[model samples]
Target: MPLPSKRYVKVNVSQQFNYHTEAFNHLVKMLYPKRNTINKYDYLIDKHAFFTESQKQVISKTASSLCMLSEFYRDQDKFGNLYVTREDICNAIHILQRELDLQNRSLLLPPVLKWYAMQIQYHFGSDPFTLKQLRLQLGKSKSRVYDAVRELEHQKIVKLVGQRGHAHVFELVEHI
Candidate 1:
């Protein structure tokens, strides 16, 4: 006789994402070798600054793959350490390829909208932001900024949480 299946799994979203982000950041630091200086451009991801195509490809693949892995973990409610295996690297390359195709479509979007999305991701991370704040940062009019935000919403990249007067609160959509 055999006992029925008995299993238990637990996960903490905050801890899991923190560990994954830290691991990815460490890998990026090792690969890109940031300048040892205090500046605004220090943390920016500039593929053009890279010396070789291979490095850029590796970075893109690894990042997208890590994001995908985190998504999987989130879905499964499984929390664990990041281990970059050969299989993961290979799958990452494939994921990167698909993402590149998606990016091509993304490129067709207006640059302002794209910039808004990037700023939200880079500056706000998971925090909510307001349309007024975005306008102030980009030095654009309310209508112009709202247009971009609307486009992002249309593309399922951002979402509206609430609005107050001329300020509309928004947050980035994950898995984008």
Candidate 2:
């Protein structure tokens, strides 16, 4: 072949692109074992006194933890009654599985989940379960129900609908 110009380079873009894909994937796997590097950095906030990437991540995670801990440890019901019963827990699990497109499988509920599930069920038509009703029906304390509601609310299966100091209203988001 005769050269048209000395500076002209015969580049086969498709062939080079194929090699680039392979090389890029290999390097990416080596650089990020979990392949979550991009998202991890994309959501990074700059409210920390750190310079390095690892330090930034540590500070960010720590801040997030503190925020969550404060919200969880508050004296009031943060969200609301989240638990219902075994069936309701199954409903939540089923809803989440559907949302995530996971395979469905029948299983027994955990004790804690059962407790919460009962909470949701016991107050199905009620704004909030009365302390007497909860104590009598579930054989548990008011504090236990309050904590269960907090835990379940965090899971998003239920919602606390009442304003502060009002008759507690718990809404089941997953069930009719």
Best by lDDT: 1
Error of 1 at 114 (Å): 1.6
* lDDT computed for candidate 2: 0.44
Instruction: Encode model 1's per-residue lDDT on 1-176: one tens digit a residue.
Output: 99887586575754554456457756755654531211122123342343245534544446544544453442222243233443444444443432233433344355766777887787778788898787788788998888888888866678888877776789887522
Which lDDT tens digits does candidate 2 get at residues 5-95? Answer: 7787676754554455345445544643432211132232343222346433333333322223333332333343121223322333333
- RMSD (CA, Å), candidate 1 to true, equals 16.2
Misplaced by over 4 Å in model 1 are 1-108, 164-166
| Candidate 2 wrong stretches, greater than 4 Å | 1-110, 122-136, 164-167
Query: In model 1, what is the error at residue 169, expressed in angstroms?
Result: 1.1
Model 1: ten consecutive residues of lowest lDDT: 34-43
